[model samples]
Target: MLREYLQALLFIFIAEMGDKTQILAMMFATKYKMSQVLLGVLIGSFLNHGVAVLFGSLIGGMIPANVLQIIAGSAFIFFALWSLKEDDDEDEEEGVRKLGPVFTVAAAFFIGELGDKTQLTAITLSVDAAHPFVILLGTVSGMLLTSGVGIIVGSKIGDKIPELFMKFIAYGLFLVFGSMKLYTSLPEHYINIFSVSGFIVFIVICSAFLIKPIIDKKKKGEKSSYQKAAMTLHDYMNQMKSNFDNICLGENKCGHCEGQNCLVGYTKDMIKEGIEQGTITNPIETDSREVWAKKAFDHAKIVDSLKFTLKYLMDNYKDLQKRDMSNAIRNSLEMALFEETLEFHGDINMYLEHIKEKNPFIMEELRKSL
Candidate 1:
C-alpha cells in the first residue's frame, strides 16, 4: 500500500507538469489568490480522480472502454470553446462567477478537468491495484504539487503575458488535447468532425479577438496606457522591496533579527562582497557613479510608489492574508494609481470601486498610506 501510494503520487506529479490543467491554474493565479487557486486544484483533482478510481476498481468490466474515451474527449472539446468564450466580466450568466474567488476557482477547475487526461490515467492505474485509497490520495497530491508551481510562477510573470494571448494558448491546447483524445478513444471507423471543425472555427475566432485589440489600439492610441502602467507598477514590487531593504541596511541603526528573513543582512553581505572584490556591477547599486546616477534616481521614483504599496501590505497583512494576497496587493496599488496622471481602464476602475465598497476601511487606509 505504501509503495502504491508513493508510485501513484510520483507518477501523477511528473505527468501533470505543463499539462493543460497546469495552464488553467496559472491563468487563475493571475487574477485570484495563491491559496484560493491551490485549494481549488486540490478539490478538483481529488474528486475527478476519485471517480476514476471507482470506475477502475468497481466497474472496469461493466462499462465500455470506448464510451469513457468518447465522453472524456467530448469534455475536452467543450472546454476548448469555453476557453475563448469567458470574458473578464465580474458577473456572468451563472452565479458561479459571483460566488467569490474560492468558489469560482473550484467550479472552474472542476469543470475544466471533466475529460482531463490525468483523471482518465488514474482510472487505468487503479484498475488492478489492491489499494484504491492510496491511489486517490496520491493522484490528488501530485496534482496539487504541480499546480503550486503554476500559481507561484504565474504570480511572478502574469503581467508580462497579455491576458488575451494566454487565452489563445489555452483554447488552442484544449482543442488539440480534446481532439487527440477523441481520435484515439473512437474506433478506426469513426470520424471526428467535432474535433477537426471545432479546432478550426475556434482558431478563427481567436484570431479575430487577438487582431481586433491590436487594430483598435492602433486607431485609438494608448487606450490601455493607464492599465499598462498599473501592470508595470505591480510587476516591479518584488524588486522594489529588495532595493528598499538595501536602503534600510545602509543605516547605522540596522541590526539583524535571528530566525527572520533578514533583507537588511542579505543586502549588506551582497554589498560588502562587491566592495571587497571590486566587482560591484549591479544597476541598483550603481549610484554615486557619474554615468549611472541619473538612471538610478529616475528608477527610485518607481520604487517609492512600491514602498508605499508594500507599507500598506505590511500594515494590513493580517486582514489581507485572510483573503487573497492578489486583492490586497492590487488594492494597495490603487493608492499609487490615483497619484498618477493616467485614467483607469474600465475593468480596473470597476475593480477599485468594488473593492472600496466592500472594504470601506481598506480604501480609507489606502488613502492614508499615500
Candidate 2:
C-alpha cells in the first residue's frame, strides 16, 4: 500500500507540472484569497481522485487490461487535442460574484480536474494497487500540493510562459502516453507510424485554429494604426472623447480604477490641472494674444474630449484584459497619448494657418525667427 501510494503521488505530481488545473488555480489566486482558492482546489481534487479510483476499480473488474489501455490512450490523445483548441474566453468570467477564496479555488479545481491527466493517473494507480484508497489519497495529496504551489505563486509564471509552447508540450506528452498504450495493446502492429500520423494531424488542426486569430489580430492592429495616422485634429479629438466615454459608461469596470472614482473623472482632473499649469499646449497656430486667449478658453472643450477618450480606454482595458489581451491595454493607452499629441499639434497648426492668412506680417516675423 505504501509503495502504491508513493508511486501514485509521484506520477501525479510529475503529470500536473503545468496542467490546466494549475493554470486555473494561478488565475483564480490573482483575484481571490489564496487560502479560499487552495481550500476549493483541495476539495475538488479530493472528490475527482476519489471518483477516478472508484471508476477504475469497477472497470478493472469488468474489462480486459489490453482494451482498457487502448481506451485510456485514445482518451488522452483526444483530451490533448481539445486542450490545444481551448479558448481563453471560455474559461472563467472576471468580477462576477466574489466566491470566498476557498469555494472559488475548490470549484475551479473541481471543474478543471474533470477528465484531466492527474485523474487518469489516479485511475492507473488504482488498477495497479490492491488498496484503491491509498491511490486516491496519494493522488489527491500530490495534486493539492501542486495546485497549492500554483495558487501561492500566482499567474506570473503563466504570463511568462507562452501558451503555444505549453500546448506543444502537452500534446507531446499525450502523444507519448498514447503511443505507449498503443504499443502495449498491439505489439505485432506498426504502431509507431500510426502514432506519428495521428500527431501530425492533431498539430495541423491546432495550427489552423490558432494561426488564423493571430493573423486577424495583426491585420486589425495595422488598420487601426493607419486610421490613427490619417486622422485630422478634430477627428482625433473626437476619437479620444469616444474612447474615454466608453471607459466611463461601458458595461465593464476598469480593474485599475474601480469603486471610488471613474476614469472619466480622473481624466477631467488631470486635464484641469494641465490647463491651470499651462502644460496643456494647444495645436492651433496663432501669434496674437487675443487668439491665444480664445483658444485657452476652449480648454473646456479639450477637457471634455480628454474625459471621453480616457473613459473609453479604461472600459476597453477591462474588456481586453478579460479576453487575455494583456498587451492590448498598454497599446491602447499609448495610442491614446499619440492621438492626443497629434490633436494638440493639429490645433496649433490650425491657429498658425489662420494667423498666416489673416496677419501675413506676423506670420513672416515668426517664420523668420524659425
Candidate 3:
C-alpha cells in the first residue's frame, strides 16, 4: 500500500506539471489572495479526485481491460482536440471578474479540471493500485503540492515564460498522451512506425491551424490598444497647454479678479492656500504652474483632440479609468483650469493638491512632469 501510494503520488505529480489546472490556479493567484485561492483549489480538487477514485475502483473492476483502453484512448483524443480549441481569453476575463476569492477560485478550478488529465490520472491510479483510498489521497496530495507550487512560484514566473512556448509544451504533452493511448488500442501487427509519425504530424498540423490565427489576432489587438493609449496621453497634454495659455492670457475671466488675475497667478495662490489648509502638504514637490503651462501649450492640439477621442474610447472600453490615463496630467490640468474659478477664489481650507497626492502614481508623475 505504501509503495502504491508513493508511486501514485509520483505519477500524478509529474502529470500535473504545466497542466491546465495548475495554469488556471496560477492565473487565479495573480488576482486573488493566495491563501483563499489555495483553499478553494484544495477543496475542489479533493472532491473531484475522490469521486474519480471511487468510480474508477468500481468501474474498473467491472469493465474489460480492452474496452477500457478504447474508451480512455478516445477520451484522450477528444481532450487533445478540446485543448486546441481552448479559448485564450479566459485568463483576461478571469482577472477582471469582481467575484469574491473563494467563488472565483472554486469556479475556475472546477471548470478547468472537468475531464482534465490529472483527473484521468486519478482514475488510472485507482485501477492500477490495490489501495484505492491510498491512491486517492496520494493523487490529491500530489495535485495540491504541484498546484501550490504553481500558485506560489508559477504566478511570478509565468510572465517571464513565453506564452507560445507554454502552449506548445502543453499541446505536445496532450499529443504524446493521446498517441500512446491510440497505440495501445492497435494490434501488435498493425502498429507500424509510420502510424506514430503520422499521428504526431496530424496533431501538430491541427493545433497549429486552429490556434495560430487566434494568437496572432490577440497580439495585434493588444498592440493596437497600447498605441491608442500612448497617442491619447500625448494629445491630452496638448489640449491642457492651449487651455492654460488662454486662461493665463485673461481670455477666461477669473471670478475674483476684475480682469487683472491671470490663471497662472491664480493657480500659484491656490497651491499656496492648499498647503496652508493641509490639503496639499507638499506644494514644493509639485511642478510649478509655469512648467505645466508650457507642456500643456505644447500639446494643446493633441489635448483638444483627446477630449473627444477619449470620451468615445472610454465609453466603449470597459477598463478605461480616468486615473489610468495619467492622473498627474489630469490633476495638473484640473488645477490649472479651475484655479481662477469662484469656488476656490476665497480663503478656502481645501485644495486640489491634497486630493492629487492621494494617488501615488499621480503624485510621482506630477513631481516628474514638474
Candidate 4:
C-alpha cells in the first residue's frame, strides 16, 4: 500500500514539474499572495484528483491487474510523446478576478485540471492500485509541492529555473518508467531479445519523429533578426540590473538608491561639504560624482532604447512568432523598465508609496536609511 502511494506521489510530482498548470500557478502568483495560491491549489487538486482516483478504482476492479498494468504502461508511453507538444496560451483567468484571491485560484485550477495531463496521470496511477484514496492523497501533495515551486520561481527567483530543462526531465522519467512496466508485465517469451530490440527501435523512431519538429522550430527561430534583438535587449537589462545592485555600499544595500535615500545625492552632499571646508580643490577628482552622473545619463538612454524596443514588439507581435516573447518574459521586461523609469524620472517616491502596502519592508528600510 505504501509502495503504491509513494509511486503515485513520485510520478505525479515529476509530471507536474514543468507542465502548463505549473506555469499558470507561477503567473497567478504575480497577482496574489503565496499562501492564498497554495491553499487554492490544495483544494483544487484534492477535488480533481479525488474524482480521478474514484473513476480509476472502479476500472481497476473491473479489469484484470495484468491487463491494467499493460494499459497503464502504454498510456505513460503516450504521455511521454505528448510532453513534446507545446502548450497553448489559454486565457484561463478570464473574468475570474472578482472571486478574490483564494477562490479565483481555486476556480481557475479546478477548471484547468478538468482534462489536464496531471489529472489523467492520477487516473492512470490509480487504475492498478489497491488503495485509491492513498493515491489521491499522494497526488494532492505533489500538486501542492509543485505549485509552491512555481510560485517561488515566479515571484522571488524569476527566470533562474529554465522551463525547457524541466520539461525534458519530466519526459525522460515518463518514458523510462513506462518502458520498465511493459518489460516486466509482458510474458517472458514475448520479451526475448528480438522483440525487445524491435520495441526499442520503435520507441526511438517515434521519439525522433516527435522531437524533430521542436528542433526544427528552434533552428528556424534562430534565423529571425527580431528574436536576436529581443534576446540581446533582455540580456543587457539583466546585466545592467546586476551591476547596479552590486555597487551599493549603503546600509540597506539597496542597489544605488533603490530605496528612499539616494546614495548619489549623499555622495554629492559630502563632496560639496568637503569643497566648502577647503579640503578638496577638484570635486571631479575628489569624488565619484562624475561616474555616477555618466551612469545616470547612460541609464536614461537605456530606458529610452527599451521603451522603443518594447513598443515595436507590441505593435509587431503578431508578425514575429519566432521571437518567443512569452507573457511572463514580457511582463518582467515591463516591470523592470517601469521601475527604472520611476527612478530616472524622479517618481520613485510615488512608486514606493504605491507598493508600500504590498511590501512594507521597503518602507521600513527607507526609514532605516533616513
- Which residue runs does candidate 1 get wrong by more than 4 Å? 1-48, 51-61, 83-142, 162-173, 184-199, 202-370
Taking the tens digit of each residue's C-alpha lDDT, what string does model 2 give over 1-370? 8888886776666556555566666555545666766777778888888899998888787877777777777765654565455333225434433666676566666666777667776786576358999888899878878677655443334334444554567566666776677667765665577766986787677767755663564454322211121222223344544444544533333334332133244343433433344233322111212221111112233334433333333323333322222122222232232221212122334634644654555445434422
Candidate 4, 1-370: lDDT as tens digits: 8887788888877887767777767756645678998998888888889899999988888998888888888888888877766565545666776898988888888888998878889999988777889999989988888888766644444344444456677789898988898888888888888998998898888877876765675555322221222233234334434433443444443344433123334323433433244232322222322233222323343334334333334433432221233222232222333332212122435634643654565444433322
Better of 1 and 2 by lDDT: 1
lDDT of each: 0.53, 0.52, 0.54, 0.61
**Candidate 3 residue lDDT tens string, 1-370:** 8987886676666556555666666655544677887787777777888888998899887887776776666555655555455343234335535667876676666666667777776786576457899988888778778778776666445434444444455455555665686687767866777876876687678877877764785565332221222233224434444444454434243233322133344434534433344233323214343333332222343234323333423322433332233333334444443331112211112322543444444333433322
TM-score of each: 0.39, 0.52, 0.53, 0.62
**Decreasing lDDT order of the candidates:** 4, 3, 1, 2
**lDDT-better candidate, 1 vs 4:** 4
lDDT score of model 4? 0.61
Weakest 10 consecutive residues of candidate 3 by summed lDDT? 340-349
For candidate 2, what is the lDDT? 0.52
Model 1 is weakest, by summed lDDT over 10 consecutive residues, at 288-297
Relative to the true structure, candidate 4 reaches a TM of: 0.62
Residue 235 in candidate 1, Cα distance off native in Å: 7.8
